[model samples]
Target: MPQTIPKKKVRKPQKVGKAQKGKEEKMQPMPVYEKEKIPFRLRDKVAIITGGDSGIGRAIAIAFAKEGADVVICYEKDDVDAKITASEIEKNGRKYLLIGGDVSRENHCQKIIDRTIKTFGKIDVLINNAAVQTPQDELKKISAQQLTRTFEVNIFSQFYMSKAVEKYLKKGSSIINTTSVTAYRGSGHLLDYSATKGAILAFTRSLSSYFSEKGIRVNAVSPGPIWTPLIPTTFDAEEVATFGSNVPMKRAGQPVEVAYAYVFLASDDAAYITGQVIHPNGGEIVNG
Candidate 1:
């Protein structure tokens, strides 16, 4: 009888202790919404911000309001969050209109424009900021539905919103799309999200050229890891704990830090600028 060969013993990876896990979870960064001594640069302008209910969008809306612009906030759901943002706008003595709808629909985009026009009379700035992301470890793990939804929300809505508001935008008007650092550097897990952001960067550049003759400026903001609601919800606890740690800054940015870029692009301060992108990405240098 042949002697049975003994299989080599393999050790499983050790699990993190509960105490260490708690310490990691506590490392998550907090989000900041406001800054001191912000100048009123966007005075008398009317702006529309998609996903204005929370995170970076909320910070932008409040920052614009502080800069003396009346804002129209477009959000999908979350009436409570919308109300909170509205309260902040009101605190700054700026008027705010909250319109809830799915921007992925062309018709809804039209309605956003229509409602803003009807209420605010004209649109001076359009911030295409709504986006969704699903992280997959591998390409095969990404589903068709996830890919479609990510594109629809992230890139398609920009096209729809821009088209819907194009005719209304006048000379000196600005359209700012929210891209991401991943658009420049790419993301291993956030494949679909990164692709949509890349598309937005291309769209912003092309649209700027098309609108150049019309005197409407188009630009984009590419942000790195920022402390926002999307962080905790989309990423696992371990990922969230280490979020933004890889950046040169070694910390996640505050929403208000990124909001300043939108304020700059939306104001006449950027009148000579178009087809450009601003990076608020924790000192991550990216070409193009």
Candidate 2:
């Protein structure tokens, strides 16, 4: 008797429609997630996070709330996102204030400090995290307007906010700047943006020294590729698809993963750490 050979079943490939592809391409990143147990590391503290309406800033804001801190979120437009963040904070049984404006403006930055002081009465932490980037393959392609806007939003706002809030920050206060991995490794396309980030790193170091005697710790968080609203919005479709593939981790990091660095810097856990930059950059080694 001969053994019967079974024929292999082959499945046909289904054609993907434009709608389906668009839906998949436009998928939003997970903005935040809470831990089962929060330690309340920032209990009773007041923190101001620029760009807190979305992306990494939103994660940091929610994390601060979970840690028992009241947060003041400074955002540039997008009232809906700001309100959503506020709702999240409130859900955590914490207070939140949403201030909408361009952080690039010095007056706006001052206004943020004034409003925070009025509402919270004191500012314990300042997370200078608002930023903007415009990619250009050639340096000559970068317009003066683009360069100025990048610098104003990315670095100048940090200066404006820091100066405005410095007097109110007491001993044990913290300032965490959001620099980028691009600052260290450099980004050919993001010339102005990377330059601003490098400036932020230097600013963080210098500011830490100035505030060291005052007991205020200044540090920077350099995040590699993180899955955030910024990725899809900033990059082309192809770039967005492969956003974090280059990282050693082989994937874009979640907002919560990078938020912990800010939380630690804001808490007593990182009291001895100052004038330093924490790399939440998916295993990329950035010297200095």
Q: Which residues of candidate 2, in runs, are more than 4 Å off? A: 1-38
Q: Whole-model lDDT, candidate 2?
A: 0.92
Global Cα lDDT for candidate 1: 0.93
Going through the candidates in order, what is the number of backbone clashes in each? 0, 0
lDDT by residue for model 1 (36-139), tens: 54367998899999999999999999999999999999999878999999999999999999999999999999999999999989999999999999889999
Q: For residues 87-154, what per-residue lDDT tens digits would candidate 2 score against the true structure?
A: 99999999999899999999999999999989989999999999988888898999999999999999
Worst 10 residues of 1 by lDDT: 26-35
Listed in order, each prediction's TM-score against the native is: 0.86, 0.86
Evaluate all candidate structures by whole-model CA lDDT and list the values in order.
0.93, 0.92
By summed lDDT, which 10 consecutive residues of candidate 2 come out lowest? 26-35
